[model samples]
Target: MKKVIPYIASNFKKDKIWMRRTKPSKRQYQVVFAIDNSESMIDNNSGELACEALCLITKALSLLEVGEISVVSFGEKTELLHPLDKPFSDNIGGSILSQLAFKDKQTDVSGMVSFVVQMLSHSRNQSINFSENLQIVFVISDGRFSNREEIRKFIIEAYSQQQLFVFLIIDHPKNSNSILQLQTISYPNGKLTCSPYLDNFPFPYYIILREIKSIPEILADALRQWMEMISSSFL
Candidate 1:
């Protein structure tokens, strides 16, 4: 005996391109950005730089007509700075960027992951019209995780449910070697690395370091590149 799969589309009548019976539904995409706010982030102008980067990214996203975005920051605890359900507006971006609060405490990576998972799950359940196309999670951190195994497990769990994209931002030069080591072990398929500290070399390291003071353009470009990559892959 052969089994048959039901064709729901067959139940509906076909229409022409210009003369359509049913109106096309709009597709909505949601992207969530998760930033790390550990004590280490406060050192070496990272906190300030991160704030600028976040402001730029959110500002850019506000201009895009594709989907909605939510921003979350985590240190010893996690907090939803912007709700995903809210409209992408200049006011929302300004409100989120204005809260440049950084904690001089440890970051709980696992806890942050748990918070994100819960948010995604809740959103998925509550959403009446949701797309399963792209769910992005960008993580910016300077140091390697103390709870490496737990973080890995959380990533795995997240991946099991939705597509995961991690953007690890290394802000400190002192943790360069450690960052490389962590990237080697923690990141799968070599998808993570340190943010470039130098734009042009052979001039002066201090010049490059000073230029790093402005992170808004850097992060905005990085996110734009990532989105372009995703679009290209789809094409």
Candidate 2:
């Protein structure tokens, strides 16, 4: 039989050891997610898909122990569905996701950008601890704008902050003649790239329905994958 060493146990209080190892730190990050809710979005048949995408992102972000997220939606007008000054709430995420189906009658990208600028400005002024990581603004749209000048100003301001990560989710090719020029001009510095169109876009459903009918699932999966890539790179 092999001889075994006698076991040793500590008598020092358990509470002291637990406190030493599990003391919480003040290292939380703020991630702002800005989504579009314009009239065109309603017609794209992607409202539900967009909502699902937002839900997935929110869910994924919730997994991070030191990160906080804010959700905002925009169209001809902007609304702060969830504020950054508070902790993440599942109820808030669900409510904001539901708004994807509530469309605006007009499409105004400039208005949306303006709203984002104002939100960021306020956040900075409030001295919120966004950490040294990044303050992301994920813009999910088809790249259509009404006031190019306003948008330009917004982009310049956001980029000047040097902490803004603009993720443009271009789901489809521009079909509007009025937006064609703006599309070419608004492309960010090598940061903007085209991704697959969300399956719910009404244009392709009739043709592709027989093959894959669940548009929400497809788009959600793509968005989730994109978000996972972002989280892995950042977090």
Candidate 3:
């Protein structure tokens, strides 16, 4: 049992007040990053950056109390760099992230969707109550889909889970259209754009999920802002 249920009764005794149970269970965040390593993301070292940034984020997320991080890299193949069953800890997060190997084949977004959907489903089933377990799925891609309809179907199904929050990456026009029907997460305007060159991109403060070939300190900022927005709802 976590927290005192609101509006509960407090009884007055001879000299003491009897109160309801107030044991609090900590709210934990399980963040999963699914990065695209498909052939399409090879340009400008995007594939390499995907893995690197994921590692950085994983390390950062471990700083939070009761935070767990898992990563899945997909090309034509989907590989689980970090297992979802394991909880993230500061000492081991980096080692787990470094194991994210990639395959250079055509991008199969539908396959990625299916793999993550299954993984999340399995993870959810582990806990009977999901209210204290927040599952955040970050799908970062160049926005190329071999089967849009199939991916769309899986995305909607995943959204039905109260704890899952799916954030799709936007880099091309095609990426924009894929998310038109999917509004599972309330993103800052339902759009996420990445500039090839962050310097050329205006107003760095507004950036979310920027495609930085070189790591940016702003990524930490973006994550903090994101964490703040979802804290009231989940935490």
Candidate 4:
């Protein structure tokens, strides 16, 4: 009987049965916001709207077990407003809004996208189970940007890596060529796929936002919809 007890104890220890624990199957998501802070954003108060939108997004994510978030602003240069290293907070969102300066004339969309892609890529590479994580990017802009080809290349790369890129173009009731150019760059075939009555383009990712007042509702809806899609994929 003593020999039998010792044998069972040794087998259990070898298998490490006591170390087993259940891990939740819920998917984790990493979100990044690339906000445009160019001079044009000052015209319709879009910069402030962008900041409010960020607050709404962070608030929504706080309700879920979503992973960390990062915020980047682009104008004359791309800058990291909120880094992923720090946890998200409403106070942080307020701080980001206070720092917004719409003085730059250039919106380097490509540079901003490149930086986000690299940041998320590095994070994924360091993870042991990266496949369980999803990368999502929300680009809020007035659509006046430079480097069309470069932006398209980075967008394609992000999509190829299974990252979700949602482009929210703030259209302030103008027949602006800059907005049209940005639409073309974002479209897969280099052509506009939306119309006046349409909010979403042929692709599910691109959306045209018209009202600054409805920023919170619109962003919350988009985030919820995308999260649903991501969750469904796991089943």
Candidate 5:
């Protein structure tokens, strides 16, 4: 008892031993997903693959507990499957999958982009400096849209708002048409290069997937690279 008392008294007086203080993370990551639900997605089982990819993404985000995600499906009209205000959970995959279906005949890219832009704009209006917010919108489609010019206009608007748009084109491995279209739409005269892994981008970026099953891993890797890029910029 005497020995314990002396040790306690010495520690209190010296104030040497204590738990380390840690600061909370200031970085905010907001991800928005726009999936194509047109008839083409059903033909190649693209719809199913997209659902699987979304499930995997939610699972990964749940595990990391680093970011919040919102999902929307677009065809003739836009449908919001998940909203940002809703908290993420591990078992929400099944619920999400049950809500998605490929039934619409037309791909409404412009409508989807406009909706996402408004959502981001509203969120930004509430904050003072949104520089810490990393806003990324992932569009999973077969590179087919109803109106090309409208889509281009919205893409520029998104860039002006400092939002990065990633187009994940669902096509065969040998096809390059979608890649070329993405480059042209995002950068008319500017030349953009992309590989299978999707690296290096001055403006918006894209990825061409041969197999639908690889969407989860590829998207996860892309997010990791973006995070690393942001971290290094601070150093």
Candidate 6:
């Protein structure tokens, strides 16, 4: 416990490493997640996957900055599991595990994105110096989102504001009708394509995750992305 104290004191400011989608700073760190918890995803252990992924990602973010996380779960409908810009409560992970493991609904990527954007916009507005804040949003799903254009539009809009948006589409049997297939349609935008295995930043970054299925892998990828983002500063 003695050793941990000084570490906490020194690292408390790590939260200052905030990224409103790019450039990790050591303040105002927030993690926004728009998760698809439809029955299918749950059946495929996506709920468990979510639990693992969230823990891993949050741990990585914590290293650079103390982070606040909000989660929005969506299906044919959407509900806020955690409100945007709020500090994480105790045992929050257990609450999320129960929700994701049991949630039933339809896939509505657009709706989820809309909810995320609204909440984030509100938080950003409340900030007098949004330019000084850093935040990252994660949109995780198992496919079959209903609105393509709307999701695309909001992503572009969020990116314009310099907020990092990640679409982690883990494949499952229920995704049979999933139209998020990359080959059939172009990704986020022509110039803004991305992969979860690595982070891409044209100017900053937007990650579209696919194929990754484990916590360690997720952590590696996330940490790599962070390193890439920080390293870009030298060039």
Which one is best on lDDT?
A: 4
Model 1 worst lDDT run, 10 consecutive residues = 1-10
Stretches of candidate 5 above 4 Å error?
1-23, 172-203, 224-235
Quantify all predictions' global Cα lDDT against the true fold.
0.56, 0.52, 0.54, 0.68, 0.64, 0.57
- Which stretches of model 2 miss by more than 4 angstroms? 1-28, 128-133, 170-235
Model 6, 1-235: lDDT tens digits are 1111223333323342332345444445567877777887766555555555565555444444455678777887778887755556547756875776445656777777667777777887798866555556776765544456667787777766656676665554344433233333236655654453222211123333433344444445554565356335311
Report clash pairs, candidate 3.
none
Q: Candidate 4, residues 1-235: lDDT per residue as tens digits? A: 1111222323213244323443544555788888888888987556766666666556656433357788888887889999876888878887888778888888777888888888888888887888776888888887665565677788788877767789887776565533443333235578656443333232247666765556545655565666677656532
Better candidate by TM-score, 2 or 4 = 4
| Per-residue lDDT over 86-195 for candidate 2, one digit per residue giving the tens place of the 0 to 100 score | 77778777677766754577666666666776776667666656444345566655444455456667677765663344544434333442222232322368686553
lDDT of 2 at 191: 80
CA error at residue 87 for candidate 6, angstroms: 2.8
State the lDDT of candidate 1 residue by residue for 1-235, as single tens digits.
0000011112212235313234322544567777777667677456665665555455544543446688888888888988887887878777775664666377777888888877886787777754544566766555434665676677777766664555555555655443333323234587765443232111110111123434433444444555566555532
Q: TM-scores of all models?
A: 0.64, 0.59, 0.60, 0.71, 0.70, 0.65
* Candidate number achieving the greatest TM-score relative to the actual structure: 4
Kindly report which residue stretches of model 1 are placed more than 4 angstroms away from their true locations once superposed.
1-27, 131-133, 173-235
Evaluate model 5: give its lDDT. Answer: 0.64
Predicted candidate 3 versus true structure: per-residue lDDT over 141-218, tens digit per residue: 655454545766776676566344444343433443332323332235768644333232211123334344323445
Clashes of 5: 0
Name the better of 2 and 3 by TM-score. 3
